[model samples]
Structures are given as structure tokens and as C-alpha cells.
Target: MFSSVVAVCIACFLAYIFNQRSREQAGDKNGKPIPGPPSLPILGNLCDIPKSHSWFRFKEWTDHYGPIVRFKIGASEHVIIAEEKIANDLLRERGSHYSSRVFLPMAAEYLSGNMRPLFMPYNDLWRTSRKLMHRLTMPSMANSYQPAQSIESARLLHDLLQDPRNYERWLQRYSGGLIFRIVYGKRVQTGEENYLQRAIKVVHNVERIASPGSYLVDVLPFLRYVPYPLAPFKQEGMRLHSEELDLFRSLLDDARKELETPDVLKRPSFAQTFLEEQEAIGLTFDQGAYVLGSLFEAGTGTTAAAMMSFLLTMTLHPQWQEFLWAELDAVVGDRMPDFEDIPRLPRVRAVIKEVLRWRPVTAGGAPHTLTKDDEYNGFKFAAGTTFHPVQWAIHLDPVLYPDPDQFDPSRWLDPSFPTYKRPLDKFPTLQNFSAFGFGRRICPGMNIAERSLYILTARIAWACKISKAKDSQGVIIDVPSYDYTSGFNVMPKNFAFNLSPRSKLHEQVVEERYRYANNLIYLKPKL
Candidate 1:
């Protein structure tokens, strides 16, 4: 009887909070509603929003409502900036008010304990974390990481040669292994470890709960008031929180142990670096652990996803793959491509650029939270409005990219293209425009990601020929359409492909390179 009474009280409190927020959302300070689909009285388009592949729906909204579109889900207002210029003006020029992350109760508070820098609100904690990340990834320091990245790329090639059937697994292992070394000061030899599987699980769980409308507690903040027994979501959040803490803390302890040996300190890992200067940073041990672990979390999945998409694209568009191969043969020869070769092979660089634009790993960039009331043109935005810079819409803009759906590396090569720039090294200039992001909140890992992708993709093309698999009848199977896995970080769906060494000579070259790289172990610094 007591429990029933408490439930009733909680329900009433939630309804009241919802009603108040609804009242606030019903009004527009400019006296005109922002352009959006028709919303119902109380629900405010709650039923209209899809839980997955929301970027596609957002692009459709842009088609009808112009570049800047606004919609309400429940009592919250969401603004999606499709125009590149507007995104620059708001998210870049006025970054002070727009750089904060949207409040995600389940993700930031319950699950991550607000340790993940990307999900953190703009505050002292975020500032400290960002500073550490920036120092790690800044351009001047990016080159130091190449040795580690090169070694891992060699290992990846060796893995692929031995087990081409599990190409996807090898790719994930490569990405995770690179980060494990960078952050934790350890190399993932086999990649078939419990840690890798659990890490993937943690990311998926965060995506499921953090995404808008996935959990009622995030949408209806008052739901947090319910008793633990009544709220399964909260229980699940607590469970995830504990699991993540244990995993990250264990990695941190391992790094700490490495620091005790002077030899390990010479090639300082991210965790070791932070620990050596923990006093100056003013972050607790656990905070440092989570910060480094969060970096690993952000880097691994997206890079792997992009590579998978690259393979899928290769299988579907053999002409492009052949073109890349022709360039590789002419420029790189039998040698694996490295950082020095980036400038010499513009076509190879263009292919990587087009791949990122065509199938962005995170289609909708992280939601930008507004800290204060703002006005754009004549439209007035409330203080708490959450903005989503929809990469799908922006990358597919017909005016910027003609026939945007088609994969054409030639567009980047053409001097006439609006977004075209010379010297692929300066491609996607951090500030003005990029697949990485916009403004103060742009991904600090951009430099690292670009470098790593170039090395891995170029070397893969140089060493192998990616094509569609064959059936028993010696007929080529049709490549699957661009169907992707569902979540915030979209990857190509499982597809059949034939990844083969380009030649017996190339296979021998990979083995020799791997043997040489394996013998020279370096402490791969985190960026």
C-alpha cells in the first residue's frame, strides 16, 4: 500500500514538471513558430521522430523547411543546422554559447559519471579534459605517433593475410590495438580478448541510452525521481556505470605499474603522462583513467567503422579501387605507404576524403547545446535549445556536392569544386569546415584519425585487391547495397567480399615488413 502511494505521488510530480516544460516550449519569443512538421498539442511530434538513422529524417526535414529547421520532441526543442555557413556562424563564431554538450542524464550522469569529455557540459571538468586531449593531439605532436601507427598497420596487413575471411574482425582489432597501446601502454596481440568485446558492448549501450527518445528518463527528466525498483533504466545505468569504472580503472592501474619501471617512462603513454603530472592537472586518479579510456572509446569504433565502409565501397565500386591501385603502383610501388607519401598521391588522398564524406561514421555530429538565448537572422532560439549539425544533410547538399549520392573522388581533384582545396595535408581545415566537427567542440582526434586512415587505407590498397566474393559456380556475387548497422556510429552491414593480396610479391612484401616492424617495439604515445 505504501509503495502504491509513493508511485502515485511520483506520477503526479512528473506530470507537473512535464506540463511546465510544455508551457515554456509552446511559445516562441519571436512571435512566430520555427519551421517544422505539424506538432500535436501535448506530445509535440514525439511520435514523428525515429529512434535510428535520424539523420535521414533530418535531411528530409531540411528539404522542406530550408537549411535551419527546428522541431520539438515532447517539451524540448531541437535545432538542426544543415547549412555550413550557419553552422560556422553559430557553432564557430559564437562558440562561447554553443560549444556545450546537450544534457544526457543516462549517458553523462548515470552511465559515464560525467567522465567522458565529449558528453561533458562546458565547465571546469570539461576544460581540464579538453586541455589534456588537445595537448595530446595538437599538430606539432601528431608525428610522434606515426611510429606506433605504422607498426600497427604492419600487424594489420599480416593479420589480413593470415585470415582474410575475418577481415572485419582484424580491422576492429587493429583499431582497438592501436588505441590500447597509445592509451594503456600495451599492445593487443590477438584482438580476440574479453576487453575488446566488452569495450564494444559499452559503446553500444551508451549509444542506445544516450540517443534522444531511447530512454524516458532522459526525455522526461522527472522520471529520475522514481524508486529504483520501479525504474529499470536507472538500474541498468548503475550496472553499466559499475562495469565501465571497473574496466577503465583496471587499465589505469596497469599503466601505473608500467610507470614504476624507468624504461617504460621513456616512451610515455597517455595514462602515464597524465599520472606523472596529475598534481598540475588537479584531476583524481579515476578521472584521469576515464579521460584516457574515453579517448580510446571515441577513437576505436569510428575508425573501424570508416574502414569497413571503405571496404564495402571498394567492393561495390571496383573502378575507384582500381584507380587507387593504379595510383598506388605508380607512386608507392611495392613499399607500404607512409606519412611522407601523402602529398605525392593526391588521388589516394581524394579517395579517403570522399569516403569520409560519402558515409560519415557519425552521420549526425555530437549535439551542440546552447547556453544562452540566441538569434539567427530573424529567428530567436531559446537558451536550452539543442542543435544537431546533421552531417548527412550537409555532406549531401546538392549545391555544394553535385549528385551527392554518387561516390566520386574526382570531385575533390577538380579545382572548380567549391569545397576543393590544394595540398591534401591541409584538407578539412579544422576551423572553417570539416568532417571532424565545428567550433570549440570539434573532435581533437581529427589529426590522429586523418593520419591513421591515410596510412592504413593506402597500404591496404597497395597490398591487396578488394572485390566481391565468388560463388561455387565461379560467378561474382552482387555486392550488397549500402545497408549499415543501426546506431549513432553507423558501419556497413555485414557483407560478403573477397580481400586478396594483389600479388605473391605483395604478400611476401607484407610478411617481410611485418617481421621487421614486429622486432622494433616502441611505446606508442597517445594523441
Candidate 2:
């Protein structure tokens, strides 16, 4: 009986391999194969996928192959869209078939409980979540959040002035605090807050689990069905999910309690609105909690990462600081920048755009799955084909951006560059920007994010000068241009840098503004 069982198991394994090979051999109906590096049997390009900086690898593959390159891992077909035009063509114009996300067994199933709209499949739940986010983050509503953004920007400047070495931490606090207030009707005054730390933990956990090839189960679906005794990842994921759920629920409960208070003038929040209309919105308590948590998760880290990248850029290229100062000094001398000044400050806007283009936080871009068979150019792809509109490649495309490797804000400022456009007021905007993503799945919080970047970048530039740090020997420490943390959103690895107030006036202004903002009625409450 043992011998017979072993024979049967071996036969089944062989049959599975044969089946996968058969599918691979089956050419597209059009007889034009999508170009890619040749794959090995069974593994099928699995070994070729990089565990870190996958976007750079994807760019190389796309350059060697065509813009639309295809490769297989197990039975899955993955396509990389290198060109912005092609990405826009399929992921945007034909969004109906390409908006869905590829499922990850570890991240989406066990960790997220299929509740994170960012990773959820295109379905009723996703639609409902998207609608809620859209309602909260529309341009008009985003504009309403500017007062909060401004206050936080002032706090950011104050934090940097007090402790410049921990600028990264302060940036994280700024983004976390802003999103926490917007999502839960509470405040995160410092990075040391317990709730803020909990939220940051959640973001870090998700980034780790969701990173491509983080777990074997993500690529091999069958591993997810393994028994608990053999699958420790399953246990870890469930524990994380439970912890995240509790935190989200607690935040929602707090929001509910605040709303119950009568005659209290409170800043409006997404959680407050959701709790008030939960029944009408048709989401359960858990679903609503995750939706709000998702917003906080999405907003916090990426914004901080972008801001950090901005600091890195400034440290490496201090010449741009003079250009920004020129604009700021001419437009609103001796005063900190406000939203009103954004229209007149094209250089500030261009710098933000250029930073996003230069080193996008989500360098790989999110994966989109095709819902039905589709043909692009001459190649045909079947339903469930995964597509990655690689931001690393698209942003660095030489045709669209000359001297693609150079960090040139002039691309947006000067008309000589191909990316340049007329009418500076609106042309350098982040609307429909490739970094925020494409199609129906595009980030809904882009309005809030753009505003945050603008205000924070402008304030930092106005108040201080960033430069390379000097060691005990008084030699400037070199900063690596491409050394970044590996994850869904990448930030520059810790590097030596110095930040100081440009003048005594700038220091005094930051102090006065922070104190004045704190005295406001809305800012008085810790919550």
C-alpha cells in the first residue's frame, strides 16, 4: 500500500508539470508571442525574479525585450508595460479590463483579510470602498484639509529646527499625524505616540508581506493550503490581521464617542462621516474599520518617503535650493509659503514633479490584472494576465525625458524639454500623474498627497538650507544616489546630511508660526 501511494504521488506531480508545460507551449491565437527572456522548465522564470529592487530588473528586461514583455512563474503570466503611452492606453483608456489587482495569498488573504481595497479584487466591495474614498478625497474636500496641512507643515519646520538629524522621523510624524487626523478625528502630535507607532507598525508589516516574492505562498498558491503545523507564515499573518483589526476598531470607536458629544465643534474626519452613515453605506463594522485603516496605511509611508527623497535631492543638489529661494523670496519674502502662493511658485511645483519623476516612492507601480483576453500591438494576452506599468522604466524613458538619469527640474520648468508644457499655472500639476498610478485603481488620496508635498517642500526650502554632513575629520560624507530601502515604497537609506535655518529671521518665523498655530481652537485638542 505504501509503494502504491508513493507511485500515485509521483505520477500526480509529473502530471502537474506536464500540464503547466502544455499551457506554456500553447501559443497566442495571433501566433505573435509576447517577447521575454526564455524560461526554464517547471520554474519558468521564477529564479529570474529579483528579491530586491525588482523594478530595476524589470526595466532591464523591458529594455531587452519590448515595452510589453511577458514572463511566467508557475502557471501565471506576468507582463511589464515599460512605455507611459502603452500603460495609459491599456491601464487607463481600457480600464474596464485592467483595473483588477492580482491576488496575493499571504498579503491579501491572511494579512489583509481581503479587506484592503488597495489589494482587493475589482468587485462590489472594492467599488464600495473606492466610492467612500473618492467621496472623502475629492479635490474640493482635499482643499478643505489645507488648514490642517498648513498647521502640520509649521510643526514640521519646528521639528526640523529642534532636531535636524532626525528629519526623516519628523517627516513620518508629519504625514502620520495628518492622515491620523483626517481618518480618525484624532491628532498625532509626536512620533512617540502609542497610536502613531501602532499605525506605523501596521504599515511596515504590510509593506513586508506585500512585497513581491516575500513568501513562497504568494507565487505557489498550493502552499497556502498547507496545514497550520507546517505553515508558520499563516499563523504570523493571522496574528497580524487580528492586531490590525483591533487598532482599527479602537480608532473607529473613538471617532464614534467624539461624535456623540453634543455642542462640540470638531474637525470633520472620514471615520466620523463613515460611522454616521455606516448602515446606509452597507459596510459592516469590520469592513468600515479596514476602509478607514486602509486610508491611513496608504497615506502615511509614501508621503514620508517622497519627502525624504526631496531632502536627499536637496542635499545632493543644493543649486536648486537657490532657485527655489529666488522664487520664494520674490513672491512672499520673509513669510512662510501658503497654499495661496502655490500658483505663483512654478519652480516649487516643478521641483515636486521632478522629484516624483526622478525617484518615485512606489518604483515598481502596483500590478493590474486583465479581466479578459486582450491584444496589444501584435501580442495577445489571456484573461487574468498580470500587468505592471513599471514606473521605474516609464519615468526614465529617454524619449519622454531626456537625460533620464539626471535629476533636472528644468524638464518641467523649461519649454525646451519634451516633458515641458505651456501655461505654467496648470501644466506641472500632479493630476493624473504616472506615479500616483493609472486607471480606476489610481490613488484617490492624490489631492491630499500633492497638497502635503507642495506645502512641506515649500516650507522646508524657505526655512533651511540642506547640505552634505561633515565627519569628525571635516570631510563631506558622500551620499549614494540609488541606495534606498527595498519595499513597495522606497525611501533613501539613512545618509549623513546637515540642515540649518537659512537666517535668524527664518528660525524666528518657524517658532512663531508653530506657537500661533498651536493656539488655534482646532489645534488645542490632543485628539
TM-scores for all predictions: 0.94, 0.95
Off by over 4 Å in 1: 1-26, 261-267, 423-433, 523-527
Q: Which residue pairs in candidate 2 have backbone atoms (N, alpha carbon, C) closer than 3 angstroms, thus clashing?
A: none
Q: Quick one: best lDDT, which candidate?
A: 2
lDDT by residue for model 2 (303-333), tens: 9999999999999999999999999999989
C-alpha RMSD by candidate, in order: 2.5, 3.1
lDDT of each: 0.80, 0.86
Off by over 4 Å in 2: 1-26, 261-267, 523-527
Per-residue C-alpha lDDT of model 1 across residues 1-527, encoded as one tens digit per residue: 68746775675566556656755754577555678887764456667878878887889999999998888765677888887788889998999999887777788888988788878998999999889888887776667888888888999988887877787788888888877777777778788788877777777777667666787666666667778887787788889999989998988887788778665444457887888899998889888878887777777888888888888888888889788888888987877788898777777777877888899887876789899888888888887788999888988988999899999988887777887877765553323345778898887777777778888888888898888999999998887667886666788877888888889999999999899988987854444
Q: What is the lDDT of residue 503 in candidate 2?
A: 97
Model 2 scores what on Cα lDDT? Answer: 0.86
